[model samples]
Target: MASGKEKPLHSLIAGSTAGAVEAFVTYPAEFVKTRSQFGGQKESPFTIIRSTLASKGITGLYSGCTALVVGNAVKAGVRFVSYDHFKSMLADQQGKVSAPRSLLAGLGAGVMEAVFAVTPSETIKTKLIDDAKRPNPQYRGLVHGTISIVRKEGIRGIYRGLFPVVMRQGANSSVRFTTYTTLKQFVQGNARPGQTIPSSVTFGIGAIAGLVTVYTTMPLDVIKTRMQSLEARQLYRNSFHCAYRIFTEEGLFRFWAGTTPRLARLVMSGGIVFTIYEKIIAVIGGRE
Candidate 1:
């Protein structure tokens, strides 16, 4: 598949594989980071960890893992594959896709990833994890949460943070893909006719790009997290309703309430995701 002319399997394989590895490496941190977004009570990270372990066991640390995995797979796979496809198509017209082409490809990939990937899992996972506080309410598990949400909110209800997801992921992809391609070119220079670029180098560039995007989009990420969380239970009606309420009632600053946790998320899980994405590409014989 990586050999095929149109699909550009290398990119998809590399990106998706890297995403999987990254998810595994930083999953625990991710669990903590996500919970932090709930905020009102302000549970210390250590307390949160201890309590989670005591109540839910190590598995609670992986609350939304299935959602994260599926979401990342769609995101990385489409990003890599589509970036190549779009770039190559542009190349045919523009005498080789330039650095900016990579930028545009990144934008495209972001939108696509948001549409095809992030929205579904993000909303579902948040709802499942952030159930309205009840003394051990009805559903503590993902499956039960999902069923409850569907029965109560219906299909549209399941996808609360679509807007924020799209905005953040799109921005992230634009910066990441564009920077990755540009960095690769700058590093390569006018090397030998067909000399291969190093995988380590490629992934490093991706990491830098990803970090920038993640940090920049922090506000939106925080808002989305809250919208998807359980505290927002009595706060708003649904995702759209939640956003409107937060904007009007809480004010714009409310959107960024969980900035610290998000930053931690970016540095830990997000950074790992970018690095591992590169490693996965190398594992699958992918090229820059």
Candidate 2:
């Protein structure tokens, strides 16, 4: 059996592996979502894919994949480690974690991930994705973009939309873990004794949880995307100002600019991440 001290490390490893797989599989959808959030006429996912292929070839669909893969892996590691730690702290003598406790644990995980991994990596990824459309892109790729941002705008530039990212990510994890844990419990509670719930069922539960997360936190996501994607930092004063401008100038639909692509990416990502995480934890004899 896995020792208590080793459980957190196992969670981190499992979560990173799951995240890397999710990033690779959903990168194309992420590419389109980033482009859509950068403020243009609403384009269908197919149109975005076609245009990206025609203009920049298949490479365009994975413009900042390097940063995404690494960032997501780190983010997932932090999330799972922090979440498991918090959940354990919240557990009762019976070792049962309540829904509210799970939600709070997820919130803590999200904030940790945003501060350590999401902000800089996402900023770089957004820059690279934005550059894919330029006739003469300023940043050649991920490495060049990172260097340029630091040289021109300083370290602060790398975390431009930290507030909104934190809000979005916090809400994302809170809703995801709460809903997923609740659903999984419901499933397991109903299962026959000695019968394990299948991975496919876990994937479906995770997908539903992801949809809940996307809708609940989409406005914050839109704000974060715009703030991070802008070449000019002076465009909006802060997160509230950015949201106000978008709402005033672009209307309500703008808040959900990339819903389709985001929905597609997140639904699959959630399923893949949770399935792999649970499977690995089971394999390692870690507490679920």
Candidate 3:
């Protein structure tokens, strides 16, 4: 069991492992969500899944899995490490953080991860998925796709939607961590300090957090996804333009086009990520 004292290295390792596992496990739903966002809101996930399977087989659902898996691992590592560091800094003498402090820490962590890991990775993943849908797909894999993007559009190509990504991630982590921390504290009431909650309880709390985060940030997510796609520049000028176009042309509900699959993915992702992270931390003798 963990001793409730977490180090940065422990957070990195545990978070990375948990993120990679979660990404791989829940990737199909992610694929569906992206396709739903890219194609149109009116198209149901079932129709997309059926069409993808019919046209490309099972592998069709995993077009950008490699990029996402790797990116999610690094992103999660950065998130956990930065969040822990910020939380520690903001913690009181007894090592307890208020909800407000936790939210701030999560925002900091989210921004860090967005700049370092998420932007490029998500850009590559979105591009790859977009490319695969083309009649003549260009890039082969993660390395080739990344190099091609950089060569064609320079480094900025891979950093598409940087602003929206940062915003989405910032809000995502802020809401998710704050919710998780507050709920975990509530659930652990009357328990001894540092006593690990049951796996089921942790999973439930994480799911709730993810649920809240998805709704709270779904618009930003939609905008980010659209902006990161290969043809975003041709379609829209900038992040503001993109948001305006989506709102004025596509309607307000368009901003939440891919909520279902995203919700499913996050629900499972939240449970799996927290459960695995805590388990790994416990085995490694670190917890917070």
Which one wins on lDDT? 3
**What is the Cα-based lDDT of residue 4 in candidate 3?**
46
Q: Write the per-residue lDDT of candidate 2 for residues 1-288, one digit (tens) a residue.
A: 111323878888998999999998999989888888887677777898999899889988999999899999999999989888887788778666688998998999999999999999999998888877889888877889899989988999889999999999999999999999888878877888877778899899999998999999999988988898855376788889899989999998899988998999899998999999888888887664
Off by over 4 Å in 1: 1-11, 44-47, 92-100, 132-137, 190-195, 231-233, 236-288
C-alpha positional error of residue 91 in candidate 1 after TM-score superposition, expressed in Å:
3.9
In candidate 2, what residue range of length 10 has the lowest lDDT sum? Answer: 1-10
- Extract clashing residue pairs from model 1: 18-277, 130-230
Predictions in order: lDDT: 0.66, 0.87, 0.89
lDDT of 1 by residue, 1-288 (tens): 111243357667767876666666666666676776664666666777898888878887787777677677777778667766766666644235576766777777778888887887778767656653334656666677777778888876667777778777877777766666666667666556567656555556655665676657766777678767755666756557766766776677666655554455555544465566555555665664
* RMSD over all Cα atoms, model 1: 4.0
Residue-level error in angstroms, candidate 2, position 125: 0.4
Query: RMSDs, each prediction?
Result: 4.0, 2.2, 1.7
